[model samples]
Target chain A: MRLRFRPVDTSFYDLFTESAGHLVRGVALLAEMLSDTADHDNVAARMREAEHAADETTHSIVKKVNSTFVTPFDREDIYALGSGLDDIMDSMDEVVDQILVYEVKVLPPELSEQVDVLQRCAELTAAAMPKLQSMKELEEYWIEINRLENQGDKNHRRILAKLFSGEFKAMEVLKLKDIVESLEDAIDGFEKVANIVEQLAVKES
Target chain B: MRLRFRPVDTSFYDLFTESAGHLVRGVALLAEMLSDTADHDNVAARMREAEHAADETTHSIVKKVNSTFVTPFDREDIYALGSGLDDIMDSMDEVVDQILVYEVKVLPPELSEQVDVLQRCAELTAAAMPKLQSMKELEEYWIEINRLENQGDKNHRRILAKLFSGEFKAMEVLKLKDIVESLEDAIDGFEKVANIVEQLAVKES
Candidate 1:
């Protein structure tokens, strides 16, 4: 019997999962931030913690890529995936930070719809990260994320219409619009992460 | 006398310059788009062309990196520079598209201030691309971009203050704020490109 070996860096997958885990934590905090009883300051603090964790994971991936002679996937793809995940976290953090900095006490009820889209995207992304090892069973992840992103766009348009319908005060409309746009950016960031993963899978397979 | 043999690929530098050139065109269209006498439709159409050209140059740089045995800079640096330049173009295009899609006439006069920052950043970026081969004389480029970005931040806050100051109607405030944020994003995108260049220069030096 002969034993064959290849230089496999499984740590990349582990760090990816770690990065996705941070997204889950961040989105959960986002949901809390949107809730009626939510404490904005506390939620923002928790979000900062999650964002810092995500950044650490991203740095870890970059360092690994820098030092590893053989990466699990293409080096560029690894870097993109790390950066994509970090972008998602950063955008989500911005949503929380804005909610606090803007001192927006009353969030539009429609904001929940956007937050729901973010939660679903995070859940799907968390589920998809592990399967990156084989690049199998991942098509549905990005497809669902895309569909959710479109749904988010619709929510955004409808919310903007309601905002401009003269119901919201001028200042409230400005605050609400800022929050809504950040939510849209978070959804878009998730789609970008999924797209990168899909591309990586195709390249690896 | 003996000539040293080295694997030098200058096409990457050429592609970077070409990408920066597209940015020059994009910002010019953006400036035109903001003018009171501007034809938004025509300016947007022209912007789409410039954005497409920038994407092609980015792809060319990526292909060159993948195929070449030795890149002029670190592989990661090449990818970062290509991506950073592309991001600036994308953000600029988004600004133009937002104006067209939102039918936002009557841009705040303060927007020109932001546009000036972008124009300076574009010039600095275009100037810096040709010097990537040596990574010399690049400090002032990023420093100047950083200064402009700070100036942009100040302009952004002033514009937001005016937007929320009850001067504009509710809907106008929302629309104007969206446009302002995109302009800021473009400025931030330029700073990001400059930051990447600074890192690349540090690495090569």
Candidate 2:
């Protein structure tokens, strides 16, 4: 008879929760960046730091998964969750980078709607990560994210229509459109994260 | 002990191959749409058909994965590969639709370089899908794709430089930049697919 002895590690759940916490901070900075009276230098710097912190957490998760033969969940699920979380941060960081690089002035009021959706998603995701081990109470997290994504989509279409309605100059329209699409991508990225979490819960349950 | 007998379904490889075939046709139509003498309606119709076909194959893969207890590889990997392939096609289709809708008269010469990259990636990806069943001889496919993506990145930077170099009108830069970025996205997506395939191979080997 062969005996197996492997201690299940619960640290991954803690790491995932920590990573999601960075998302909360990242999105808050994103909202600050979108503010009209913002200091762009400080906002960009803070977002950059948040993104780096998120990256480190992702790297830690990947390393732990690679070293441990018996994981808390499937290997690919861990990878997918880590990558999904990292991608959302990347999208948020890109929005801030573009705003700075393009020297975008005259911020759109419509962008606030997308930021609002993002903040809600961050909160939901941060809340959901801690419950991953229990595999309970995650249904609402994903459902709310889906609803929020739909809201972001509607906001995106409205913003695009306004951009093409000739209210702004052609140059401003171009600059604003990139920022708008980045926000949309960030929102969609959050939905991807939520979908992965839902799948993980189903598999674990 | 319980006895288990489940047949391995190989139809997934065929469906994936079929989906990659659509990518080949999709990118080719995208190239045709960029041509100065393109028959826009016919090309759009064909691209739409290609996108629909790809979507159907993706749905089939997901359905099969859901119903079967044993998949050929990780379920998440299958999902990621399917969604990745579909995303590349979607980005290609968006490029065509934007070009047509924007109704820009002049197509930048740099765009042809991007189209060339897309066509090559489509070819490599289609050729690699059949090998998924064995996961043999895949190293070259991903290496070539990574190189091509780097090439695409360079082309993207040059195109952006040209657009903002005061050589183009504000409206023209806006219209063309969107199209260029979509091409870059398609190229990046191919790399993503290749990366997923590499990971799957590593796990399954």
Candidate 3:
């Protein structure tokens, strides 16, 4: 029996960038949902719909990974990138799920701030994705991504510290805590993506 | 101007694996600290020590990455793996730090159980690291790792459901929730390591 090797394809990169775009869209939907003064059920439904879209995008990437022989980058890198992107979506979905499940009616000011930062992080991540395929362009975006990630981290620490202060009611604190942590996790996911792109640039150079 | 390429050395792989070993040890230390009925300050110190060790390990890997011309795995994979392993350790440290900061006295039953699971997951991750260097051996351990990960997921879901059942005191519920989520995140980190190992095996085959 003879073994065959397939030529590497760049399709995985395309699919991955597409998935990142979906994540950005999902986060955008979530931002809108959070901003609206809608019923909990309606907000929950919209959040679920956004999550479903992210899941579909994730499935597409997974299928591409399983079928592709040659990937533009390392197969593991592709998987990491895919999983990192999915994690951002998952973090957003988890926050919405918590809000609905806990029957949380009010969003804290701190949580709103975290969500605002998260939306910015998602936007930056989506913008950076297209530039990943071009190493020259990566340098331009990579520094910005890192700066945004650091900003997210600072926001996370600020919110977390405020969460522990004896100001808010117990339930309010609990709700805001979860939201802050989820937002931080989502930003961390974006940072992971940026890290991968930066490493790719290093490898290509 | 002439460009120079240095020959790839085994040092990068050596440093990465060594860093992985350090991470596994850090997690073990965290688990031990969690299970101990030690003073709060003592536990916090111990956790901090583990974090510092893991940070030192990360520094070593990063230094090697900066200087190395070639790596055994994708440079991004190397970075991802290193960062992921460090993340698991950091999450473990964070859990312990929270316990101390929050002045938590008794361990939640669910969180204690998850710590045991995390220990097992870390051990599996450590065992898988050497096999990653030899891709042919990865498949043998892949199933076991996945099985363990599934078990961790089951535990996560079970505990989370219990959390929502209103069985514990409100403050207890809040603290335990954070600890449980962190433990589950650590397990997910281990599962990520397994996933990457499986990908490496497939690519090698």
Chain B TM-score, one value per candidate, order as shown: 0.93, 0.93, 0.85
Select the stronger candidate by DockQ from 1 and 2. 1
Score chain B of candidate 2 by TM-score.
0.93
TM-score of chain A considered alone, across all candidate predictions: 0.92, 0.93, 0.85
Ranking of all predicted structures according to DockQ, beginning with the best and ending with the worst:
3, 1, 2
lDDT of 3 by residue, B35-92 (tens): 7466668767877786777777776776577667766776656776777788887777
TM-score of chain B of 1: 0.93
By DockQ, who's the top model here? 3
DockQ of each: 0.15, 0.14, 0.18
List per-prediction Cα lDDT, in the order shown: 0.85, 0.87, 0.71
Candidate 1 on B55-140: residue-level lDDT in tens? 88987886776677766777667776787888888788878877776677688888899998899989889999898877788898
- Name the runs in model 2 displaced over 4 angstroms: A1-105, A119-131, A134-178, A202-205, B1-10, B37-53, B100-103, B136-166, B198-205
Interface RMSD of each: 5.0, 3.4, 3.0
Which candidate achieves the best lDDT against the true structure?
2
- TM-score winner between candidates 1 and 3: 1
List of clashing residue pairs for candidate 3: A8-A70
For model 1, name the residue pairs that clash. none
What is candidate 1's lDDT per residue for A27-78, written digit by digit as tens?
Answer: 8898899898998888898889888988989999999999999888888889
- Give the worst 10-residue stretch by lDDT in candidate 1 chain A: A196-205
